[model samples]
Target: MSAMKEYALGVCYAHPKEMYDLYDLLCGWEIAERAVEMEIVERFGGDTYPSKDMFEIMQGIADILENIPDEEALVMLKMVSLITDKPDLMEEELSFWRGRCAA
Candidate 1:
């Protein structure tokens, strides 16, 4: 499946509150996918599938979450948690990204 569709599914699965609006989810997905593509290109010299650098991928995700509002950040945390299969890390990841924004 496409990255955007995979991201949307993860977000919907981990949604913390009320259902996310379709438009907002789609917009966020586009933003996230773009970030992923950029990171992939930067790290691998090509925008290829199955990124090899976990650190860069996480950095890309953190960057995306930091730019958006807190509410949207929660949704993104959920998506990241789902993708990473580490729900326990959500708050810590959020805090890390928030700290990066502060720095």
Candidate 2:
């Protein structure tokens, strides 16, 4: 299974524990869910610049997605869009992810 899927399904921590959680989960500073962090960026407006924390999450997301195969990442984004109320946000993120896809 892909790292993202494994993380999503609680199958395992595919990356280093620090990669999964920048702080609190490690440094006991701020523990935030990846999904919630994604929504934070969306709530702040996709076009607007991200705040520091949001940017951190965005970077983290990029690192996470990097571990996934391009096709799998696209499909995963599509699947997530179907179940999310914020399908548009997912689509927008998917577009961004597609651009960043390594292959």
Candidate 3:
């Protein structure tokens, strides 16, 4: 089963406030993700930026994403989808970085 679905089922009996806490955490991550995107675009927009530095930045972001538990990551992605009003943004952008780090 999907981690998110699993999480939902597992937490079915938890306090309502726990869900709110998860929402708050995901919101913080969404803001951090946007900040990272903006920083990358502003600081590394052109050929003038060194590839090595760009790789380091990407890796750092990827590491942050990777450190989250898989279930929490799935939950965060779902929350981001709901919050952004652009459903594919996090999956596309963050997944690309995550893939890069994996490679």
Q: What C-alpha lDDT values do all the predictions have?
A: 0.43, 0.42, 0.42
Tens digit of per-residue lDDT, candidate 2, span 3-67: 86665534222222322332212122132333434633444435445568756655664555566
Off by over 4 Å in 3: 1-61, 86-103
- Candidate 3: TM-score? 0.26
Error of 2 at 13 (Å): 15
- Candidate 2 Cα errors over 4 Å, as ranges: 1-48, 81-103
lDDT string for model 1 (1-103, tens) is: 9987686656544433322222122232324444434543544466444444544444645454454555455544445434233323434544544444344
- From the highest TM-score down, the ranking of the candidates is 2, 1, 3
Using TM-score, give the best candidate's number: 2
lDDT of 3 by residue, 3-92 (tens): 866775454223223333333333334344443443344434533342554455445444545555445544444443444434355345
What is the lDDT, from 0 to 100, of the residue 31 in candidate 3? 48
Assess every candidate by TM-score. Answer: 0.27, 0.31, 0.26
Off by over 4 Å in 1: 1-52, 83-103
Looking at model 1, residue 16 earns an lDDT score of 33
